[model samples]
Target: MRIPESFFVIYQPKYTVPCVFDLNERGTFPNHPSVTGTWGFRVLADTDLKASVQFAHLVHRPGKDPQTGKAYEWMVEETSIDLDDQLTLDSAAVEKKITDSEIRSALMDAFNEWHDNFVPMKKKKVDIEELKQKLGNVVDECKERIRKELVRKNQHWVSSNIPRRIHDFKYGLYNHVKERLYQEYQSNGGEDSEPNLLKKIALFNRVLDNFDHEDLMKPDGTVWRNEDEIWQCWIGFAGSEDEAYRICRTMDAVFKDLELDEVG
Candidate 1:
């Protein structure tokens, strides 16, 4: 009942801040002040739990407006959150509670069901004709519409007079071509063109994959590169009555590895 590590969504949280410096009153820079506030952690356990909290701070800055040479005031806002507390949560408790063998088994079962339901095969035929009919003329057309909509919705990233809508349309067109090729190969005798078809499918799939947000933060109090590492740690400590003590040891190791002070 072991699950492929990728089946689970591992959470990781990261903090970012500017470096600070102390300067001599004589206009000469003197020493480097400690730079703090950046760290990352992965949530190995409790997929359902919300682990991090965000806090914000505000500031005022002075500036001048170009139109009116007179001095004008401006406001600059600064924000920060304290992650150190949650980042030190006991890892053993997380592993024991979240990534236990039973949870892994359940995840595998769910993943298998999802994979079987989605992947194309001979015996389990996907209703291409129905999909086409429901989605106007071409199956590619439907995918294109979805892709364009996604890009349009994220128009903040686009610039230039070309119109953000045009960019999305072009992206959608390219994807449509790739999907059409895939559908054609699948409908015709798949053996000769199957590999090429799969390549095209992968290409279009990659485009669709780009719609996810890149800045998502993981839950607080966990630190592992990936889900597999988290699961391995969990499996090592499962089924023990002294779960808290075991968790403390695991946390100690994690902190040492990250060069962080041990949390009590």
Candidate 2:
């Protein structure tokens, strides 16, 4: 008896119609592309099979008959296999054979063998190098902003009377950027590589630059402090200090550099 269609899973290539595989009494299966593409099917369950099997590939020639005006399928490839010669299958043996590296690799090889025969070739090529350069530029810009707008501001914390206030501003900015990077990493297949880190840094920097007092106020006239509000004092503060402190940080090296620049 033929294996039930439900017992097989077709590993059809993306953007291609499924190739039909139908078994007959003689163990011969003739396959043709729906339009013209390739696919491989795998048997998920063990079943009784014929002693011999033959596979044939058919192609639908593009041009139509001048008189009949109908396309025709032409047999282009053929192969065969004898199951009895290959093995006597027990559950363990079948599982081992299917999982074997050679067999697994062959499955992918067969799937990729099919290609578009009818379509004309005129696909636009992507400039991968150009895209890479642009991405590098954006990351570099983010790094520059981090140094100038964020790290450089550490000078204020060095001399300020209220040290903890400035410390939270620095700490808050660190957490904010870190949180942004973590979120981006989770969405990006968990790769915390330098490039991805830089991208997220650039993104959070923009978020900080756009912070506003009007967006953070509550109905009771108190400033709402959550992820959005990076610093304290939503009402009395009338300058960019709060926003800068919450969004950026100062380091010892940056503070030293600021003093030197001032002396010069």
Best by lDDT: 2
User: What lDDT score belongs to each candidate, Candidate 1 first?
Assistant: 0.32, 0.35
CA lDDT of 108 in candidate 2? Answer: 37
Roughly what TM-score does model 2 have, to 2 decimal places? 0.18
Report the lDDT tens digits of candidate 1 across residue range 61-126. 345545555443322222212222222333344344343455435433443354344333454564
Q: In model 2, where do residues sit more than 4 Å from their true spots? A: 1-16, 22-33, 39-54, 60-79, 85-264
Looking at model 1, residue 151 earns an lDDT score of 40
Clashing pairs in 2: 154-250
TM-score of each: 0.18, 0.18
lDDT of 2 by residue, 188-247 (tens): 344445443343334343333324554654323333334323332211121233333432
TM-score of structure candidate 1: 0.18
Clashes of 2: 1
